[model samples]
Target chain A: MTEVTLSNVVKRYGKQQAVHGIDLDIQDGEFLVLVGPSGCGKSTTLRMIAGLEDISDGEISIGNRVVNDLPPRERNISMVFQNYALYPHMTVRENLGFTLQIAKQPEAQITRAVNEAAGILGLDELMDRKPAELSGGQRQRVAMGRAIVRQPDVFLFDEPLSNLDAKLRTQMRVEIKKLHQRVGNTIIYVTHDQVEAMTLADRIVLMRDGHIVQVGTPLELFNTPVNTFAATFIGSPPMNLADGVVSDAGTIVLRDSLTIPVPKSARAHVKPGQKVQLGFRADNLMPVGHAVEEKGELVDLELTVALTEPLGTETLLFADLAGLEVQAKMLNPRPVQPGEKLAFHLMLDKTHVFDAASGVALRG
Target chain B: MRRRIPEWFVLLLPAFIVIAAVVLIPLIFSLYSSFTPYKLTRPSTLWRWIGTANYEKILTDVKFWSAFGRTILFLTIALNVELLLGLLIALMVNKVTWGQRTLRTILMFPMMFSPILVGFQFKFIFNDNIGLVNNALQSLGVSNAALPWLVDGNLAMFSIIFAEVWMSTSVFAILILAGLFAIPQDPLEAAKVDGCTPWQTFRHITLPFLMPFIFIAMTIRSLDVARAYDIVQIMTGGGPAGRTELLWTLMSRTGYVDARMGLANAMGYVSILLSIAFTVYFFKKLSAARAELGMGG
Candidate 1:
């Protein structure tokens, strides 16, 4: 196992730069995931680490050795592509043994390694079948098995579970986590799915337009995003944002007469008549019956219920808060009809306030 | 109720009649005449049933057997050489990033020329004294003696093989290039990540994927080369004491110039066996390669 460091890494295709100079230090045996939307250069960064794509500028070191000039084989890295790129002509046994054969290992050793990988992946019975004969999940396992048998210093996964169905993707995510724990190799996985990043990464690097917006644990990003993009991008159902202006009394004034007092934590960042964006997650806005007395500010608002989505244990309520559509969660919710006004309390401690023009967060 | 003829059969009757007149009748007539000593000059000789006399003579003829062996040698050399050269050209062309379309179009130039025209072109280039090769060699101080390219047995065979390969190697290159394009990029990357060198990746991944395409090109070129008529006829005409006589050249002289149609018909039937054997062999190899790639059987 080895640590991978990218110092000012940048990638360019012709004149258009896909990845700006971004620095990341991945610890040995750490599962770091690079997550972003499409065109966010997350996959490009992974490919650069794999040596599949050349870096336009800066140095990439694996195990503290500069590998910019080395080919992929010399770098001692194994990559699992988004599409499970198993050799179509080879059976699972051969696919797992390919790297060992190329390295000229002994026949007995190669067989032992292949068998061990097969056992790890529960692929012993399917070892004789070609990739085309395997199901999608089986192919994914074989792809991972091929990487596992190599015993490389670093394992690179380029959205390896994207092609599987939703249920299978979740299953494979667990398997990947278990494999990482068992093998303890440094892994850099790239995915557009936030849930995958949240579930699988030890530290998640969120990027936008080739720039890293945040680098933190999943809860850190969920609790405190540095900007509006991270706040919404990391959470499912996204953070609800509304335009507001700071009143002369250090309160946020919404559409007409609606107002909320700024939390003491962000009071210093606001000024009179300063335009700002108010952000809060759906779960923080509790309905009246479920509201609890918390240490932070609790402001009650009479919101007209626009819609409700029952999700077994709780219901997601879409309501209009002072002319702004906002989503709130109701625990122990009874059936509430549309156009009904309900009192909902805003958990100001959990709410985020951003500069309207710059989208920068105001909380400490 | 009266039974009615199928409308599809009625619609196809014209094609059937045309095929019978143009294809079926000639095939049957040739099979029938192969048993007779039918001479073009003596029409009545067509009725004389020889009953495998021509076949027996051809089976025993040293000249005919030599031509048959030479034809096989020529086909084997041309197909293998063309495939190798075509693979080289295709690999080089596939690497070109800029002006690839123009290069692809230029690669087809040799195939556009007629075989007979190519024959004349090589014939003059290999002429004993005044040829371009001889003049260039002498002027460059490489040799003082005139090289008899069309006279010596080996040189004559080499010249013919060169012309054939030059004209047809592009067929393999074009088809294999198409196969190269059809290959997905993921497997190649996977091979690289699996620690394969460039050459190993090519041997293990790229070439296996192109095997079916290469065999297809070989099947087509083999049939075309086994007939080996126009180029040899124009370049050497089975001359220099029959040193480079292919089966088609020998059979043509026997049939048309010698007017012994019965003997020529026998030779034609025997040569057809070569084409069928090559076609079957290539097809089997193609299917095996496809199966190894996990395609349909």
Candidate 2:
């Protein structure tokens, strides 16, 4: 088991810095995902760890060995690229056995490694086929199979599912997770799709603008994000944030003469006249009967439903609250029209308070 | 009254007539002449059909056979050597980041010169006493005596082959360079990540992608090399006991200098078999390479 550690690692392309000396320690056998929007240095960071790109500064150690100067081949790492970079001329068997062949292994050993990888990936039927003859998903599996045959110390996936269709992407994501469990190797997967990160990662590294915004369990990142970027980036329909200020009465004052008591977790961190933003998820602000949980402190609001999106089991109701459009979930079926009135319970304890100027979560 | 001709056929008639007058008629005339004792000066003898006499003479002729063998050797050596040098040059030029466009344009300088000009230029360069090569070697003190670059039996063949290779290696370089440019970067990157050394990557990944282009260059150069008349004639004149006498030089000497057009036409038709053979082989290789890359038609 190899644990990858990056300490003050930096990547610079000429005058511009892509990854700014970010430090992270990935535990052995942990499925760590680096996720961000485009140009966020997540791929650059993973490439540096994989030795595909050079690190401009600091050290990255794999299994307690400093691999700063090692080539990708010497580093003992296998990587799956975004475009599924399978050798187009070679058949599936050749592609899988290439590394072993390059290493000058015996013909029998090469065949065994190739066969085992093919079996693991359900690729026995495809051994004679070339990459161009396969579909996108099949090619992706071949790419994964090639990586598997090497049996490297670590596995790096750079947006591996980005090229697949939505259905195929979901299917491959599960296969990747299953492969990780089967191999039990340290895998560092990079993706901009938060759902993939949430489903696949044991712990997710949310990055923004060359900085690590937060590193936490999927649930931890979903439940308690460190900042506004993390809160919006990690969850679907993103946590609804409303502009507000802490008033003299120790309540949060919002636009259009509305006020709510501060969330208990951020109460001590708020000062009178402090400018802040209130954050709550769609599940936290549902209508009375459809609330996921009513254990938290609740404040009722009569809001006009601006839109309704029926998602079979649950419908997301968008309402105008203090001129900000807030999404609230409806667990029960509803034939709701736009501008209809509904009573939504705002869960105060489940809400977050961020300092408006800095966008940092105000924790007690 | 005659039925009105189709408009498309009417429109295409001029092209067909031009092709027949300029190409087909001459081809037919030459084929007919090859069966007769048609000397250039004796135009009346073109009608006298001496069936297979010229073909029989050349089939038994030792000089004709030697020239055919020499042409094949020239093509084999020149094509392979050009391919190797072109691949080397293209790979080096592909590596340069700055001024790459300028370097590519400079790389095409050999192709820009006319074949006749290239011949004369090499002819002067291979002049025994005052040639650039002999002068350079003498200046470097590598040789104390003047080397005969175009006179000795082996040296004459080398001079003509060197001149021909210099004139045409650029064709291979340009085509192979285009192949290099069109190749996907992902496979190269994948090879590296798959633990391939640079040489292994080149052998397994880069070379396979270039095979189709190499075969196409080979096909085009085969026909051009079979017609290797101008450079050989200028540099050595297939000379000094016919040491460098290729099929083109021998055919031209028989057809023009000896005025034996029928004999020369027979040799021409026979040499075309060589071109057709080379072309078919390269095309088969090209298709196989393309199919291997999953680009099969």
Candidate 3:
């Protein structure tokens, strides 16, 4: 029942605006992640919901209660900050029990709640030690235990895993996902890493500047990005895009040399002689004989390999198509030297077309 | 071997001579004088070694003991009140978003005044006649009588303690303010999200973090307040019947006005013990506070 909703939420600092009016609806028990580059207002949005930052001109409600003027404690929400923010002077037991203690619960009740959280987070042996005595990962677990002891309706995480190393971050990501599954509480997490957003989010809210670019599940945003920004921002090496023009014969003119039939999904959205950009990920474009058969119409091209990155099982081949650099994947990786010619197949079904001038997706 | 001076002692000779001349000699001289029946007016009495006589007399004197007790009481009350007031001021100033620097500078104004000047300022303000406190009270119709602020035993003591606090509270404030600034904002924010009320946050997160700073201020001010002489002397000169007399005033009066250098030196030695005790006690508390903050003391 702890569904969080933000309608036209805006944040302004004096003369400048940090977050424009944005609408969001977070479902109960759903793990939603707000993600973007630095200064994209994703953190600001989360803080506003957590009641740490004030919303300049919008209504925010938790469980049907308009909490615009209510204090954080009254909102029944717990937050884990980027830095663990453990009480340095207190032991892990005290840190975990603090919220309940503050609520004036009986000492016995607080101890019970603390012990439960400790057991859940595997903090039993470390209970007597202060935050300074704990390692980064241990401190992070204490912070989560502190947040859980309150048993709040919703949990808010602001780049909580950003401080950990790459290996630790991956480990904590699994811990967080497992924690969410066990707790079944509505969680709103924020991070700048797209991999985190893709892996952990039931829904990802991609933000840029002060606006939300798009909101969808990981597969939806990956398979169908709204525009060039989404296409380029989601995948690791980024989706390869080439500038081209629409032809009168249901084909695309690329660099004035090669002509490929337009992707069927975008045929209705483009008119003859219109400017457009062709977008496809490395996964969709594969070298022949190394790739499985794609049911979608495949356009074959013999492109010169510029470079190849061998990633253990698969090799990423960088090839030139009409003087434009594009990435293609080779599943059954074999060493290919630079300037070596290789035949590649572009899966038209997965390929996306965009209005070049507007950078808007042409798919219906 | 005895005929030859060791190279290590030779290397240290210059430093030893300098320290002995500057610091050790004066300390030894004072200790010697405290044991002798020395009088400043008669240099001939300097050689008279009357061991334990001065200490025995001063220890038995009712006035000396009273002044010693008064100094301790003054230190206790003034230090505690100043600590509490300074913490309040620092917390309030930390909340100011803009013009905080300007406010902090202004907060230090009281500390800039010399203790003597502060004593005079408060003496006049608390005067029964032609003073600010009395005048304001009379005009406001709060009282019709001119209360003897510097004559009554309790009021005179209050006036001097008030003066000391006015001149020194800013030390506590500035230190605590620095503590406030140094405290990471993360814990405070965490406290807020953890359902702590403002008071609870301050009592738990803010105050515990400020403990080391508070103890540091106490350690410094304990030494400063123990030797409170200038302000007490200027305002009361150890009386209106010796009501506001303290250890410093009693010692200075015995040595200078009464010319009993030996007895005064004996009193000074005793008071030095008090200062040392306070310092050691505060240092212990400071280290304990640092330990609680998980900083290895």
Candidate 4:
């Protein structure tokens, strides 16, 4: 296993900078997930590491050796593409043993290595079958088998599970994690799904518009986001953002023109009459009747429930709060009807405050 | 019982009738003529049946047998040389980064020219006296004596084979280039990552994938080459004592010039066998190559 480090790595296509100067140090055997929206250069960054793209500036070191000028094969890295580019002409056995055969390994050794890899991937029965004879999930396994048989220092997976069905994707995701654990190799995976990023990554590097917005552990990013982008991006149902200002009555006035007491910890970060944004996770909002009204920053607002989702374990209420839509997860099932008003308590201690103009999270 | 004709048969009826009139009837008429002493000018001779006479004569004729042997040799040599040159040109063109489209269009220009024109061009270039080739040699003083480019048996055969190859090699090149274009980019990338050399990648990956296309071009050109007529006719008319006489040229003299339609029909039926054999061989190879690649059974 190898540690990968990118120091001021810049990639530009003509005058358009696809990857702004970025630095990241991935520890040995760390499963780093680079999460971003489209056009965020996540794939480009992965390709550069794979030597599929040229680095415009700066250097990349793998296992403490600068590999800026080396080709992909010389870098001793194996990449699994999103499309599972298995050689269509060869059988699964040949596809797995192809690298060893090229390296001039013995015929017996090639057969042994391929058989072991096929056994691990559960492709023993399909060793002789061609890629066209297999199903999509089988092809994905064959792609993984091709990579694992090489035993490279690092494994690069570029959205490998994106082509699978939803159930198969969940299954393959666990298989990939197990594969990483068994092999104990450093893996750098690129994906757009935050759940995949948060679940699979030992450390998630959140990117936007070709720049790393923040890099931290899953819980660190979830609990303390550096900006509004990182805060809304890493969670499902997303963080609810409401516009407000610090009032002269020693409270925060929301956009609906209702005022609630500001948390004491946030007083140093805000001043009276200053515009601010209030952010809180969906799970932090408690249904009015179930919550103790006097214990936290309780606000009584008319919420028109737009939809209700009963997820078996809990229910989600999609409602318009003070003319702005937000989601609140409720543990106790309620007869929350659509297009009807409801009351909720917002836990001010669990809430986040951000600078209105700069979108930076205010320190508490 | 009352019967209702299907609407699908009505739609297919026009094509079936046309195919019968254009192809099937002619084929049957020719098959019948092969067993008869029929001539184009002598209509009543169609009723005169001669059992195995024409076939026996053709089978025993040394000149006809030699022409058949020579035709096969010419086909084998010309097709192989054309395939090699076409593959080389395709590889070189595929390597070209700049002006590739222009090079492809230029390469296809030879195919656009009729074979008859190419025959005339090469015939003049290889003519002995008062020709460009002889004139150039004499002017350069490389040879005091003029070489016979079309008179000698071997020279005439070589001249005709050269013309045939030049006019058709691009046919293979263009078709094989289409195959090269359809090959996915992934395999080559994977091969590169697998640490394969350029030659290894082409031999193990690219060429096998291209075999089906190569065989298809071969089958089509084999039929076209077996019926090669216009160029040979325009160049030498199978003349100079029948030194370069292929089947089509020999058959033409037997039917139209010598007024022996029955014998020509016999030759025609024999040549069709050759065409069917080559087509079957190439088709079998194509299927095997596809199966090897795991494309389909």
Evaluating just chain A, the predictions reach TM-scores of 0.97, 0.98, 0.98, 0.95
lDDT (Cα, 0-100) at B239 in candidate 3: 88
lDDT of 2 at A282: 90
Off by over 4 Å in 2: none
Tens digit of per-residue lDDT, candidate 3, span A1-364: 9889999999999978999999999999999999999999999999998888988999999999999999888999999999999999999999999898888899999999999999988999999998889999999999999999989999999999989999999999999999999999999999999999999999999999999999999999999999999999998879999998999999999994699899999998999999999999998889988886666799999999999999978899999989899998899798899999998899999999988998999988
Query: lDDT for model 1, on a 0 to 1 scale?
Result: 0.93
- Listed for every candidate in order, the interface RMSD values in angstroms are 0.7, 0.9, 0.8, 1.5
Candidate 3 — which residues are off by over 4 angstroms?
A292-295, B1-21
The pairs that clash in candidate 1 are none
After superposition, which runs of candidate 4 have C-alpha atoms over 4 Å from their true positions?
A248-251, A260-267, A271-274, A288-302, B1-13, B130-147, B152-155
Sort by DockQ, top down from the best: 1, 2, 3, 4
Worst 10 residues of 2 chain A by lDDT: A287-296
Compute the lDDT of residue B11 as modeled in candidate 2: 100
* Per-prediction TM-score to the true structure, in the order listed: 0.97, 0.97, 0.94, 0.92
True contacts kept of 3: 0.85
Which candidate number would show the highest DockQ if scored against the true structure?
1
Model 4 residue A344 lDDT?
77
lDDT of model 1 at position A262: 84
The sequence of per-residue lDDT tens digits that candidate 4 reaches over residues A239-300 is: 99888998877688886777767766677888888888888887877677654343755555
- In the range A342-361, model 1's lDDT, one tens digit per residue, is 98888988888999999999
What's the lDDT for residue A313 in model 2?
91
Model 3 chain B weakest lDDT span, ten residues long: B1-10
Deviating ranges (above 4 Å) for candidate 1: A290-295, B1-3
